[model samples]
Target: MIVLPYLQTPRARIRLAEASDAPMLLRYREENHAHLSPWEPLREPEYYTLAHCLKTITEGREYALQDRGYPLMAFDPDEQTILATFTFANVVRGVFQGCHLGYGVAERMQGHGLMREILEPGIAWAFGELGLHRVMANYLPRNERSAKLLAKLGFEREGYARRYLRIAGVWEDHVLTARICPDG
Candidate 1:
């Protein structure tokens, strides 16, 4: 099994999602449904349940073990409530050596630079430990906050895609951006 080390900033701590986090994960999703819906895929009723969270956490752990993905959860200093999540998915080995980045923060936690704090070390781990060459993050053009965040994090605009993803039950376009490994 891949044992991930904890990553911390002054305001929060990040670690791989665990089965034990199911209840809080479910609660986080439920509480932020409306806040996140515009940026995420439409969810079924079961998606907010404890069982779903358990299954997802289990699968995420398995995927991490296989080096296919890293699903991380960031929590407040109390370490009980989930404040954000950052997923490094679609990890490609060989010539690609890259992954897609997806992330979200609690509605109440926005505007605090918490996502930036969470991602800095996470991306560092991807480059330093995982040896990835590039990390891609995409956002809707209308999401100025996300655009700004990605840019601030050194992700350059690569291109745009039409109907790039199905979010909120509709196909939405996305602005593609990527950051290459600084040491590469």
Candidate 2:
């Protein structure tokens, strides 16, 4: 099984979200709604609700239990505030031994390098715990921040996709990138 309270940095404590985290997550989503919408699947009206946050956290919990995904969150040291989130989703074992990564930082915390600190150890944990051979991360072509971050983290661009995913209610193309496990 995946571990919890996986890593800690001066600015963040990275782990899976718990039921008690619903309020903090709801606040983060509500506060950063506009900032994230353009890069994310369009949100429904109920997505802003406390109930929706709780439900999603519960689903994340189930995903971890099944070894299908790990929805990790970077919380402040006190665990009262969320700093960022990254999910190692679509985990596959056996021949594939790979997964897809999706992440976002809180709007107010942008450009502070908190995501880097959180992801460094988090990615290491994925390679160690899951023994994954590859982790893929994709982003819209216009998302220079993501493109740069992934590059800095050693994710090499592999290809481009046309109309890859729907974001903010529109189909958007994406740049595909992947990082091989150091021990792969």
lDDT of each: 0.93, 0.91
Candidate 2 lDDT (Cα, 0 to 1): 0.91
Name the runs in model 2 displaced over 4 angstroms.
Answer: none
Prediction-by-prediction clash tally: 0, 0
Q: What is the lDDT for 86 in model 2?
A: 94
Candidate 2 accuracy as TM-score? 0.97
**Candidate 2 structure quality by residue, lDDT tens digits, 39-153:** 8998889999999999999999899998999999999999999988999999999899999999999999999988778888888888898788999999999999999899989
Per-prediction TM-score: 0.97, 0.97
- Candidate 1's TM-score: 0.97
All-Cα superposition RMSD per candidate: 1.1, 0.9
Q: For residues 158-177, what per-residue lDDT tens digits would candidate 1 score against the true structure?
A: 99999999999999999999
Give residue 150's error in model 1 in angstroms: 0.5
